[model samples]
Target chain A: METKIKEIIKQVKKGDQSAFEDVVTFYQNKVYQICFRVIGNAHEAEDLAQETFIRAYVNIHSFDDKRKFSTWLYRIATNISIDRIRKKKPDYFLDAEVKGTDGLDMYSQLPAEQLLPEEEVESLELQSYIQQEIMQLPTKYRSVIALRFVDELSLAEISEILSIPVGTVKTRIHRGREALRKRLRRV
Target chain B: MSCNKQFINLMHKYLDGELTRTDENLLRSHLHSCQSCQKHFHELKRTTTLLKSSSELQPSSNFTEKVMASLPKEKKRVGYMRWFKAHPVITAAAIFFIFMFSSVFSAWDQDSQLSVSKDKNLIIQEDTVIVPEGVTVDGDLVVKNGNLKIDGSVNGNVVIINGEHLMASAGEISGEIEQVNQVFEWMWYHIKDITKNLFAFTNK
Candidate 1:
């Protein structure tokens, strides 16, 4: 897979624009997941995810060949996400319906009559509550926590993606977990 | 229900699924005996499990297509201009260096025809410049792509580029005589000329 991604990146570097679509298709979910978790908004996450790819495409030459492409991509995703929230307006968090604010929010686009399993519905609510607690964390801790648990990335990988030391990543993840526990205690 | 502080660190490792089996057993035994650690472990577990079970959220179906649709077209020419604009100092330095080297190299090849800086009493033969035996050349004499056979005195420096010199037994030069052939020396000469010009400008 690494070789395949490197080949795709090589093609992108060689000025094959269509080759970049493969890169976008391949990493979109992971990038979107990182952006969504960090930004806490589906619509804006999609926007930022697109921005991440566009930025990646524009700066493809600047992508260092030595580093993992995914790490570089996530770096862009996380930076865009953190930057978005830092330049915060209070309404930036995706409500159940920040309807028509940005077009076709996935949350609103769900079929109205489609039934979900009871267990799944309860679990999704639990997920939503957890997401709220995640949002409450200081933004620094929030990203590491999301990268750790949501992305299920290793501390070393998180360090590379965030350009921080492994020890600092561990400290943030530990502190972030404690913050979540405190917030969860409230509900 | 006091707990060992090390156990708290172990609890974090356990949550990360990083605890060695032996340490895990130790933690398990401690948690079983200690109510405070047990409660704390559960709270930590709840938070971690909640985060770990993050609902795999997918972007809308057209997410990729939308990303594809909106990607700034892979810019070709403008990108260079954009790069140049973004790093003004580097770009300026690069252009200056390139201009200097290019003009130097281009000038190097064209200097095969002989040229001299001062012509007063300086005799020019096809590829030989003669400082006539009896007449005094007034100032500095520069000869390029030729030979200088000097028989008269020069009051200032004599610089020869890609050339040779022959001095008569009576020939006199009051200032330094330098023969510059290598590109490096040419660059140094350029630097000297620039600094001299700058010095003159500053004095003015």
Candidate 2:
């Protein structure tokens, strides 16, 4: 699968327009999901997803074959989404302080081990709540969390995509998870 | 209390399975005994699982087509200016070399005392006229039907008729250099020279 992806990327790099369409077809859903999760809006996610592919197409020559193509695509997607979010809500991070139990920030709080009830209804509710809380996370935290959990990207891959250190990625993920745990606890 | 804080700190790494075997064992034992830490671990695990299990959102229909439509018709070719912008040092060096070459060529042309005359009608005389170094002609030096070469100094004007004028770098002319190779050019030069003397007389 990796070799096939590399082959398609090679074709795309060679100005094979049809091959680019195929590339888009293969990665559109994943790209859209990442954008949607980060942006939390269907319409804006679609626009940003389309923008990501268009940017990738225009700058395809810069794509280094040494790394994964998906990583490059994710980097474009996340950057576009982050830029859009920053533009739309200039003060987004200013209000990033999530209310926590006691005086501590929600990210500093450890999760409590209440076994989630294994019922379909409760599980669905928990899923919805988790999604909502994930959206509420600050853009930085939300980005790493979505890339790690939603996209199943490794810490190293997230680091490469975000152009940050793996340590920073881990810290964001840890904080994001704790933030979600706090939100879930309130529910 | 410090031990509990330490365990809390390691909880994320433990859940990630990034812990060393001994640390993993120690964390496991701590979790087993500490209800709060164990509960926290379970919640973290469940939250991660829920996040991973969330279904992907499908984009609107024709997402691929929209992206394809929006892409540029063709890749932009890197123009010379863009390349220059990318390699400013190389461009600067190239421009410097060109300027240097032209400067050197001009200096050589001046030093050689070549036929610097612009009038194509001017004829070259077989006999070479040389104003030797240290020779200074004070009054107007008019040459008719002969080449005039100046390697020293002329304090007054030099006028040539039907001949070429060559001036070396060491030559210095304090006044005008005029060449008239045709009958009409000679007439015009005289008329202009007479007009100039009239204007000087009028001014005086």
Candidate 3:
């Protein structure tokens, strides 16, 4: 895996755009997952993911070979997500669906009807409920929950990706989950 | 770690299915005995289960294509080989730089040439001579039976022969400013007479 990443980096340096596409394909799902969890919306997550790739493409030369590619990607995504939050400053955490470029509500395109009708109904209900409850979490805990559980990144991976201590990751995850449980019970 | 904090951290790991068998067993043993941790662990599990079972929203199938479409075209990068083969924009820029370089050097060359020619007894018959300002010329200035005035300034020796030379009061020749009147000198008369006699002798 290390050898392959190095080769991809080399190809990127050689101006091989296709090699960059391969890097995008390999990390897209993980990147999208992180974006979605951080922002808690599909459309914004997709936009952020696209922007992340574009940023990576423009700045590929700065990538350090000694570091993990995944870590570098997450760092880019995390910074972008943080910037979005700082800009939006929604009332109820980052879950508010602002109008998109086309002037249509971004979250309105969710897959509410695609799931088996009964599950679809339940899923929509649960999604909204989860969003509200997750929003109630302290931002730090909220971030941990989003990065760890929603994104499915390992505690160690989250620590490395966020540049926080491993102990901090574990503590945040625990506290975040605890706070989330309280929010859900209240609902 | 104490069973209290260990229970909470392990509960998070267990909910995420990241706990190993040994840790899971230890956590379960602790939870069974500790009612508070047990209650917290159970509730944490239930809520996380709810989140996991929540709608797994993948972006539209066209998502990647849409992103690709939103991006500007890949900009068919010209490889080194093709870059040299002739691109209109590149060619234009190259031509512009060449013109600029030549003009800059030509202007410098012309200025130097004009200063040198001014010192020589050669008169600039045409307005083609371009003497850039602030340059010094060291020689004599003799505009024989013509005008003589320095346009701007002269710092070094100013020697001119036969033509008008303008030295604005601002013009200061650091070297001696000597304007010898050479309407007809002894050397010129002797040389002319000898040349005329030589022609007569050659005819004989």
Candidate 3: Cα lDDT at A60: 78
Q: What are the Cα lDDT values of the candidates?
A: 0.79, 0.75, 0.63
Q: Write the per-residue lDDT of candidate 1 for residues B130-149, one digit (tens) a residue.
A: 88877777778889888888
User: Which segments of model 2 are wrong by more than 4 Å?
Assistant: A93-128, B1-3, B75-204
lDDT of 2: 0.75
* DockQ ranking of the models: 2, 1, 3
What is candidate 3's lDDT per residue for B68-137, written digit by digit as tens? 5554444555355346565778877888768855664454344322233353323343422222355444
lDDT of 1 at A164: 93
What is candidate 3's CA lDDT for residue A89?
Answer: 79
Query: After superposing candidate 1, which stretches have Cα over 4 Å from the reference?
Result: A89-124, A185-187, B75-204
Best by TM-score: 2
Q: B103 in model 1: Cα distance from truth in Å?
A: 19
